[model samples]
Target: MQLEPGAVVEGRITRVTDFGAFIQFDNGETGLVHISQIAHSFVRNIHDHVREGESIEVKVLGRDERGRLDLSIKELLEEPEEVPRPRAIGRQSPQFEAKLRSFMRDAKERTTSGAPVKKSTSTKRKK
Candidate 1:
C-alpha cells in the first residue's frame, strides 16, 4: 500500500477540479494529478482530460513537502511527436566564415581609423 516514487498504480478519479483531479488508489491512498500532468499537450481545462469516477493509470511523481502524493498521467502516456525546427535561409559554414572575415576587417578598419565606431541598434522595428 506504500506508494513510492515512480510507482505506477490504477486508481479511480474521486473528484475533478479546475486545477487537478483527485485519484483514490485501490489501496485507499489518494493523490492529486495536477492540470499540467493531465495531458502531454496544454490542458486549459482538467475536465477535458478526465472525468469523475473514471479509472486511470498514473505514475507517482513522489510526495510533496506535506507528504501528499503527486501523480502524472502524461508521464504514463506515449511521447508526443517532435516538431521540425525551422532553418535560417542562406546559413552555411562558408557564409558564416565569410561573415566572420568581413566583421574582422570592419573591426580592424575601425581600430586603424581615428573615428569612433557607432553602436549598432536592434534590427527589429517597433510597431
Candidate 2:
C-alpha cells in the first residue's frame, strides 16, 4: 500500500509511549502518532487515549527526515464545537460592577492624595 500523506488507514497500536503511540499497518509499516495529534483537545497522558493491541484509524501526515511515517488520530475525528466566552462582568453582574466602581474610586482617591495603597497581610501565630 502506498502510504502517502493525507491517506487514511486502519492499524493496530503496537506500542504507546509518553510522547506518542506506534501503529503497525497490515503491510508491516509502522507510524508514530504524536501525543499532540492523538486528540483534538489537550492530552495529559498518551496511555489514556491509546493502548497496545488496540485498533484505531489514523491519517498519514507524511514522513519525517528519517523517512518514518507521521500519523494523526485527531485528524480523522471531528473538530469540537467552540464554547462562547462569558459576557463581560460589568454587563452581567451588578455586584461585580459595584465592587469595581468602589475599587476604582478608592484607587483614584489614593492617587489624588499621594498616598501609597497598603495591602493587609495576616500574621500566623505559633502555639
Candidate 3:
C-alpha cells in the first residue's frame, strides 16, 4: 500500500539511530521517524523511546527532497497540557512607596548641596 501524506499506519522498527528510527511497513515501504517526532518532550536518546524490531503506529508526514518518507509518532500521541505560570507580584505597598520617595528626596538634596553623605553613629549606645 502507498503511504500517502497524512495517512496513519502500523510499521515495524527496522533500525534505530541517534537521529531517528527507520520503520518498515507491511507493504515493504520504509519511512523515518525523527527524534523530535518521537515524543512531546526532549529526546536525548532514541533508544530510550524506540528500539530495533519494535512495532508502533506512525503518521505519514509526506516525503522529503530526496523522496524519502517522513513519519511521526508524536503526532498520534496526545499533546501535553501546558502549566500556567504564576502571576507577577502586585505593586509595592503605600509605606514602601513613601520610604522610597523619602530616600530619593534626601539623595537629591545631598547631591544638589554637594554635601557628602554622613553615617550616623549617634545611635551607638554605651555597653
Candidate 4:
C-alpha cells in the first residue's frame, strides 16, 4: 500500500536509536521517527518513550528526496494540555505601582535639583 502524507498507519518499531526509531509497517515499508517527533514533551532518551518491537500509530509527514518515508508519532497524538503558570507571590500590582511611584518621585527630585545624572558604563568603547 502506498503511504501518503497525512496517512496514519500502524507499524512495529524495529530498532530504537538515540536519534530516532526505525518502524517497519505491515507492508514491509520502513520509516523513521525522530526523537523530537516521539513525544509531546522533550525526549531526553528515545527509549523512555518507545521501545523496540512496540506497536505504534504514526502519521506520514512526507517523503524525502530519496523517496524514504518520514513519519511522526506526536503528530497523530493530541497535543499536551497547557498548564496555567502560577502568579508571582510578592509582585502584586499595588506593590509594583508603589515602587514605580517612588522611583518616579526620586527621579523628579534629582532632575529638579539639577544634580548631574550618572552615565552608564555598559556601552562598548570604540577602538
Per-residue CA lDDT of model 1 for 16-100, tens digit only, reads 9999999999788899999989877777778878999999999999999999999999999887796334565875799899999
- The TM-score, computed over Cα atoms with residue i paired to residue i, of candidate 1 is 0.63
- In terms of TM-score, the best-performing candidate is 2
Residue 18 Cα positional deviation in candidate 4, in Å, after optimal superposition: 0.3
- Where does candidate 2 clash, by residue pair? none
lDDT of 3: 0.91
Computed on alpha carbons, the lDDT of every model, listed in order, comes to: 0.90, 0.91, 0.91, 0.89
User: Lowest-scoring 10 consecutive residues by lDDT in candidate 3?
Assistant: 79-88
Instruction: Find the 10 residues in a row with the least total lDDT in model 4.
Output: 83-92
lDDT: which is higher, 1 or 4?
Answer: 1
Model 2 residue runs over 4 Å out of place are 83-127
The per-prediction tally of clashing pairs is 0, 0, 0, 0
Candidate 4 residues lying further than 4 Å off, grouped into runs, are 83-127
Enumerate residue pairs that collide in model 3.
none
Off by over 4 Å in 3: 83-127
> Could you give candidate 2's per-residue lDDT for residues 39-127 as a string of tens digits?
87778888888989999989999999999999999999888897335466555488888999999998899989977778897798779
- Residue 95's lDDT in candidate 4: 80
Candidate 4 residue pairs in clash (backbone atoms < 3 Å): none
